[model samples]
Target: MALNRYYYPTKYESRAKVISLGVKCVFISHQQNDKDAARKIADYLINAGVDVYFDEYDGDLRISHQSNNARAVTDSIRKGINNSSHMLVLVSPNTLRSTWVPFEIGYGYDKTDLSVLCLKGIPKGSLPEYIRTANIIRDIYDFNIKISNVLEKSQSLLEETKLMSSYANSANPLSNVMDAMINDPYN
Candidate 1:
């Protein structure tokens, strides 16, 4: 919640224009298996004019991971975190088995405004110890509220996007993953 927001006057300003540093850029961290779901979240944010650093579109990160080049991949993740003002850790069943997700969380914990976005069916009790302590976005509505707070947007604006209706009655972006989740979030 304590994200460092710095705004500096542009040196080459056409009249003392102020520029914000990574104002609403969000770094999305999710397991490889959850790429599709992550993309949906990213798309939703993008539609709302938020900058997102989803690894799915990072060619360098993809090549590094495919080559098993841990150093390169780590560098890419670090760079992504450095450029983002916020971090959204997408939590699902697959997240429990991920090696990189934990690292991302740890690295970005102090660097960005971090929040754990749990998929539907993931109980508060089932969250990992590290994640259990952070701000949690339980469902799509909660996500909308928390993100809108960060963006300083009105609920009316979100409703104007026509996405809220799609997410009504469990039609959320990660509805498939949410539906596939078992009663037990750990396993």
Candidate 2:
């Protein structure tokens, strides 16, 4: 219920270097087994110029315990999603079984842009309902594409970027104009 102030939208022109607004992002994954992979995903995003607000890298914000920790973990993930513009959910077999991950996804539903990247072994069939709706990527490279798209939708600032430059130059100028007028006046 707290207001989120950390989400930032990046703007990039077709030929111009991508300019990041330093958006705060949250990483959600299995704590015990997927922690290392979570760090790797965070690192990849960081290297690509997006700021990451992962619990593993940020702090021990996510609570730990057996049953009682559920509320605390949910609260922590909610706060993270609330404060972040985007979420990077690492999907694996372990991730699919995680109750907290679904809670996190539920907290983020229709609230923040979400990107789900599955590790090599994770099955698409095992994905939870919330994450199943996400554009699934097999690896890190595919993750970047999904992330870019999610970021673009969330920001409304990357439409002009080369990644989606065609959208800006689409045949439907009316829609673009309306979007510019309604969603992005400066763009």
Give the per-residue lDDT of model 2 (tens digit) for 47-140: 4445565766323343344445666665556555655666667767777557677777777666556767666555335666766676555543
Error of 1 at 140 (Å): 0.8
Evaluate residue 146 in candidate 1 and report its C-alpha lDDT on the 0 to 100 scale. Answer: 65
Residues 2-84 of candidate 1 have per-residue lDDT tens digits of 22111112122211121243256688999988888887877777665666778876778889999999999998888777767
Q: Relative to the unseen true structure, what is the C-alpha lDDT of residue 44 in candidate 2, on a scale of 0 to 100?
A: 45
lDDT of 1: 0.71
Candidate 1 residue 108 Cα shift, in angstroms, is 0.2
Clashing residue pairs in candidate 2 are: none
| Candidate 2 off by > 4 Å | 1-26, 29-31, 58-71, 147-187
What Cα-based lDDT does every candidate model obtain?
A: 0.71, 0.50
Error of 2 at 135 (Å): 1.9
RMSD of each: 7.0, 13.5
lDDT of 2: 0.50
Q: Give lDDT: candidate 2, residue 32.
A: 52
